[model samples]
Target: MDIPFIDLDAQEKVIGKKLEGAVETVLQHKKFINGPEVSVFEESLAKFANVNNAITCGSGTDALLLPLMAIGVGEGDAVFVPSFTFVATAEVVSLLKATPFFVDVDMKTFNIDPEILRNAIIASKKMGLKPKVIIPVDLFGQPACYDQINEIAEEFSLNVISDAAQSFGAKQGGKPVGGLAHITSTSFFPSKPLGCYGDGGAILTDDKPLAENLMSLRAHGSGKNKYDNVRIGLNSRLDTIQAAILIEKINILKNEIEKRNLVAKKYSEEIDKKIQKPIINNGNYSAWAQYTIIYENRDQLSEYLKDKGIPTVIYYPKPLHLQSAYTVFPRYPKNLKVSEFLSSKVLSLPMHPYLSSAQQNFIISSINKYTKEK
Candidate 1:
């Protein structure tokens, strides 16, 4: 049998019955839009993340967009983001007509470097742009250096919006991802650690006023009634069926995260030593969204693994700043050397909660064999 990169089938075997029941319940209710399940899931999600509010949205992009809208980000405002993250991080800023000022990432964590972010904020101010928000991405399921990022935000009076698309089940300083930033956004894309069946995302926060605004913003900016348009907003509502599906999945997420960590631990211990392993900082626990490694011969290993029926993927082969559409945007330090270097070296191996021991051993040995032969 072919080794699947993420065995959703295996996950189904573990929770298929519950998932069916959840879906059936939604079907029985027939309230697909903004149904009862949506609110229940939102409450559960907020509790899981230890936040006061969790507002469900249409997609991960909307999760980021809703917060920006609530905060009134607009033209001439500069939102500092890591150059290495998915485009959605900066794309939301641009959609609001704000400038996406790119910053370099930390060599170890692959997250926005605090020093670089501070410098970027200063430089943006000098360039006559208003540095209003800092959107730090928690790359590869691990939380970024929030302590430093928060300090820098304080110094500059910037709002910190954590793009935690991959780090939802992770923790920093014992606090969950949702509570780590002023406003945290996460994705439930099918591939994420705690994904639902389809595109789903949520924004988490403790500020009730901000939460109220986000709730309004996710809808058509309604006030008192759906027709009472208070502010400009998008029609981004989480489907009831998706919410029901996520409720079942979220119940098992903690256990699944634990299993994922065990798999990551075994891989780290047995994989080739010459290839650099993911560096997770102390006081942080990752969701293990993808167990990525850094090696000079990343493409070669990926090709070799494919030939061996072992699938490997590069999270990103190009940095956002270097992308054609993003080339015109401003970048701190001019070069973004680390983001560029990581783009060339990083390769993600198969990662999921249901990876069997035998399957994992095969992947490790295959990598070692290639390392030895090359």
Candidate 2:
């Protein structure tokens, strides 16, 4: 029995006919770029996220870029972000020639720590860099501690960008993750919880002016008309075909999220208590992007599971601040202990809505057997 890390084929089989129909509609219309389907999907996404506007773009990186460009995040601007997240969060800031200051995350939540964020802001100011933005990531699938993060942002007069690339279907305090920040960016990469067939992304915001700016930024800075280029921008429109497929996927996303949660719950219940499981805060819900756990000997455990034909992965083997490309950026001055520690111990097991009871039992028993033998 081969267990998949993420059973995308199982999900595709469930929605294959609807997906084919959507693609066929796009093929017949032939309005491939910026077609009617794009707007429809954007509207649907905005409604689902409970945001006033949603701007679709080419990829999650582009989703992060548009907002930075819209708000003038350029050279010398200090952009704060968690070191534990995917590089794209900091990559976008670096692309704009801005300085990315790394902040460590809370060990339990695997999200940015607000107290450290305040200290980072103060440190940035002391270094003569203008503090501008805070990009808090919803690492794995859970929403960050937004209540405290928002307060810190307000105190420092910093704009917040929620990196919802992995947490789109998650919620905190009964509100969707996308609506928790000034601007939220999400991916539609094939592996995301509410993914499309190919690369895609969207930006959600309540500010109309910013939404207009995002639309302009995603299309070579077009203004009023296509030929009228106003500002420097990238050609990053989310294609119509992907949008059409996303429509079908989004309709069933709620059920999929519930199923993923069920899978996560079972892992917590049955996996060895010595392995630190993902922690979700009260009134918060994760999309369960990856059911990650931390153990002392993560490499040995991963290899052991691999030998058993159970796939596993590490979210980030090294913190963003320690990466070679990011070595020049300013950090918290003190060591980011938690981020660095998590980098050494985190392991993501098989997690998806379609994972079976038998498959999960095998994975659980295999792990229990290994730990006991050790």
What residue runs in model 1 are displaced by over 4 Å at the alpha carbon?
none
lDDT of 1 by residue, 1-374 (tens): 38899989998998899999999998998999999999999999999999999999999999999999888999999999999989999999999999999999999989999988888999998999999999999999999999999999998898999999999999988899999999999999999988989999999999999999999988899999999999999999889999999999999999999999999999999998999999999999999999999999999999989998999989889999999989988999899999999999999999999899989898999999999998
Each model's number of backbone clashes?
0, 0
**Candidate 1 residue 369 C-alpha distance from true site, Å:** 0.8
Tell me each candidate's TM-score.
Answer: 0.99, 0.99
**Whole-model lDDT for model 1 versus the true structure?**
0.93
Mind giving the per-residue lDDT tens digits that candidate 2 earns over 63-94? 99889998899888999999999999999999
lDDT of each: 0.93, 0.93
RMSD of each: 0.7, 0.8
Give the backbone clash total of model 2: 0
What residue pairs are clashing in model 1? none
